[model samples]
Target: MSAPEPAKKPNAAPPVTRPVFLARATYRQRRMRDAAALLPILGALLFALPLLWLGQNGGEARTSHVMIYVFAVWAGLVMLSAVITRILGIGAAPQSASDDAGAADTRRG
Candidate 1:
């Protein structure tokens, strides 16, 4: 027969376990931050897309079309940034006077 397992002490606390998932708000904030981080890369790729068009049709891509595309991409990126910032509550909090004073003190030191 197999030996019996040792019993846990009666007074010992149960082992703590981490939560399986983040809270809804925390998960959303993290996702927003991730989107914010990826925004620049997405913009870079979008801007580079026009270059690919330049090589197509024997370099016949129209300058006006490219300009329009560039502007549209720029506007889209700005809007996306604004949305992410708003969702993440970036700069939403009012700055306290003490915070400014701390900065000033740091600069003087």
Candidate 2:
């Protein structure tokens, strides 16, 4: 009878291989990203204009031009996140599992 093959070492590293996508969801993700990209520019304008006005009127205190830019960037990110959430209908779940979960978790004796 042929001898059995010895077991390999436990710490033997696995070979690395690149993943192949059967079908990429590229177009939808691209569309969502493109839609999301529009948000930041609009948000920056919306926030910066009011801040610039405040600066011009000497109403804004303790904020420099650089600070204005930072605030504008933050506002832009917030806008983009909001846009993505709304576009993806994140909070529009149907009355099902979430409701059941809430009911289950609510002060059950």
Candidate 3:
């Protein structure tokens, strides 16, 4: 059994609240990985701007359809190579687990 108390302190400390959530640094790492994905898209946008400008006159090609088809295939191969390299991490993902670990150590250090 406990006795009831009726006492008041004139200067009581305020109640404290702590934040409820925390995040992993790997989240930032994943964000950087996603940003690496955006590079090819940036490159494509860069390539598109000049084509858009050139076609601003809305002129048709004088060559036969075969020429257009061949160029399309050539462009496809180049874009495919870019996509494959980007997907395989040739851009900015820094190539090695060793590098990732070294970065982590550097950040900590």
Best by lDDT: 1
Sort the candidates on lDDT, descending order: 1, 2, 3
Q: Give each model's whole-structure lDDT.
A: 0.92, 0.71, 0.62
List runs of model 2 lying over 4 Å from the truth.
1-30, 33-63, 97-106
- What CA root-mean-square deviation does each model show from the true structure? 4.8, 11.1, 14.0
Looking at model 1, the pairs that clash are none
Best by TM-score: 1
Tens digits of per-residue lDDT for model 1, 59-102: 76989899999999999999999999998889986789999999
- Report lDDT (Cα) of residue 16, candidate 2: 94
For model 3, how does the per-residue alpha-carbon lDDT over 1-109 read when each residue is reduced to its tens digit? 8888879898999889866644666565566577666756865665454443323267753445545655675686577666656555566754698988988999997
| Ranking of all candidate structures by their TM-score, best first | 1, 2, 3
Residue 60, model 1: lDDT of: 68
Whose TM-score is higher: candidate 2's or candidate 3's?
A: 2
Clashing pairs in 3: none
Error of 3 at 85 (Å): 14
> TM-score of every model?
0.70, 0.38, 0.29
Worst 10 residues of 1 by lDDT: 51-60
Q: What residue pairs are clashing in model 2?
A: none
